[model samples]
Target: MSEVPLPSLEVDVPPEGLSIGETARATGLSVDTLRYYERAGLLLDPAPRDGGGRRRYGSADLAWIAGLVMLRETGMGIGDVRRMAELSRTAGTEASRLAVLEQHRERVLADLARTRAHLAALDAKISSYRHAVAEKENA
Candidate 1:
């Protein structure tokens, strides 16, 4: 199947910022998960708000949340992601960020190798099944 491009994070979030419910709807994440991310420090500080003090999320915030989702899906630990988020808040820390990213890349590579091996094993089993079926038909 052709790759489906993800919606532009920049476009989905409004300049004025969206409420928690809006963000959840845009990101396909639940309100509870968004709150959990905030509590986990995975998100940077949201924009300040008016009376009633509702959290407002801008485009940048949505972009960051999308990145967090990608990281989590790629097997990054929440603690590590939280640390990365803290590091992002610091300026002039390219070297530190690179180190963390490199470590994560290594882990992902290892995981990919294991996954490929399992897929190969499954493929072999499938081939065996096909051959067995063919032999039964011939006999």
Candidate 2:
């Protein structure tokens, strides 16, 4: 199978901070979900504010949120993701970060193995069904 390239880091640079509405439009996420992520402690830094004090998100903020979205898609728990975010706040050391990632990686590997096994079983069942259907049609 052809390898799919990972998303580029270019999204990491947001020049002019975007309002919540603009960010929602850019990321294809809802404003309510953005607020929910903030409330859930999934965001690394507090979103900045415009002159009028409305929440504004920059490229770095979007990058971090995209990472959170990836973790969620991978079936990571919100609480664990929050813990990872807390670890990220201390940028110097990466031991804690590595530990968290290693643990999650193990979990993901195990889940993937199980999913593949289930898929194999389903394929076998499907083959059996097809054989039975063929026999019925021949009769």
Candidate 3:
């Protein structure tokens, strides 16, 4: 088999940095969510704002926001996210960060296991109903 090269996926960033709305569009988050995150201090310190008071998110800010989005998407609560963000700010908080993430990871793994088990049970029930219906039709 021949190998195929993937197409380029580079993004062009402006020198002045992207506005909050532009960052939201690129990150698939709503403008309100971006503002909420910033207001909650879930991300870094006050983002650079334009003279007119519009937020101008830089590349690093966008990257950090992306990580926060990932954590939220993975079922982490806002409190936990905030704690992790806090831990990340100070010096020598590695152990605390590890502890926080480990606890969340355990919970997520347990939930995943329960979901799989429930799915299997549902599948079995569905299969039984299908068989019963097929038998009735044949009769």
Candidate 4:
């Protein structure tokens, strides 16, 4: 089978960068969420603002926002996300960042184990029901 290409949400970014709305569209985040992230200090310092006070997001900002989105979607808490953002601002904090990611990975692994156990139990019940029905029909 041929692999299908996913539709791109990319927009043409001008030299001046994109407006807050355009960024929200490109990043799949709401305008309010973007504002909240800025206010919550999830973003790096001094995100570019235009002369009219509108937010201008450049490529670097978009990439950082994508990382933030990935961490959040993976069930990272806001506090941890904030910590990761803080850690990113400074140099030589790779170890700290790795620790945070490692902890989250542990949680994800535990959840996966529980989910697999649940799936096994469900499959066993399903097989038993199928066998019972077959036995009844044969008898």
Candidate 5:
């Protein structure tokens, strides 16, 4: 099957910034998720508000959210993600952030190894079935 090209998530923000809906589209998150992020204190800085009190997201906000999406997709829990976000806002927390990522890396590596083992078992079973069928055909 041909692979379909996906739209780029990296968006260039204009001077005016993006509205909540625009940000949601750019980040591949729902509008409700954006509001939840605000209430959950996952953002480094509060979202800026326009004259009418609508949320406005700038380039930095989009970049940060992209990272959050990646982390979540990789199976990082919400609490850990929130911790990383909190660490980002403070000064001299680089080591803490590194520790969090390193821990997640280890977990991902373990999962990959387990999945590979399962794949190997499946391959061996398929090979045995194919051999049996070939012998039967010869008979």
Candidate 6:
């Protein structure tokens, strides 16, 4: 089967900035999630408001939120993401951030190796079954 391309999560700069709904669409997150980020302090700061006092999301904000989504979806706990956000807010925290990410990367690579091993075992079993079926057909 041909692989279907997934939509890009990359946020383009909107000169006027994006409204909450537009930000949700661009990031594939719900408005509720965006609001939760505000309440949870997961972002750099609560997204700034526009002239009318509605939340206006800048491109930078969208990019940051997308990263948060990636981290959380990649099995990072909310608390860890919060810690990383705090680190980002301070200066000279690069090494801490790298350590956190390096740890997560190691976990991911280990999981990948385990999954590949399982897949190989399953493939071998499937080949054995196919050969058995072929022999029965010949008989």
Among the numbered candidates, top TM-score falls to 1
Tell me model 2's lDDT, rounded to 2 decimals.
0.80
Candidate with best lDDT: 5
Query: Higher-TM-score candidate among 3 and 6?
Result: 3
In the range 1-139, model 6's lDDT, one tens digit per residue, is: 2321222366676777899998988888899999998888798778889789999988678768878888877788888888888887887887898898898888779978999999999999999999999999999
Of the two candidates 4 and 5, the one with more favorable lDDT, higher being better, is 5
Cα error, residue 94 of model 2, in Å, equals 0.3
* Root-mean-square deviation per candidate: 5.5, 5.2, 6.9, 6.6, 7.2, 7.0
* TM-scores vs. true structure, each candidate: 0.86, 0.85, 0.85, 0.79, 0.81, 0.79
CA lDDT for candidate 5: 0.85
lDDT of each: 0.81, 0.80, 0.80, 0.84, 0.85, 0.82
Tell me which of candidates 2 and 5 scores higher on TM-score. 2
Clashing pairs for model 5 are none
Prediction 4 TM-score vs. true: 0.79
| lDDT at position 73, candidate 5 | 84
The per-residue C-alpha lDDT of model 2 at residue 103 equals 93
Q: List the residue pairs that clash in candidate 4.
A: none
lDDT of 3 at 62: 73
Q: 40-115, model 3: which lDDT tens digit per residue?
A: 8898566898889888887667777877887888799999988988987876887897899899999899999999
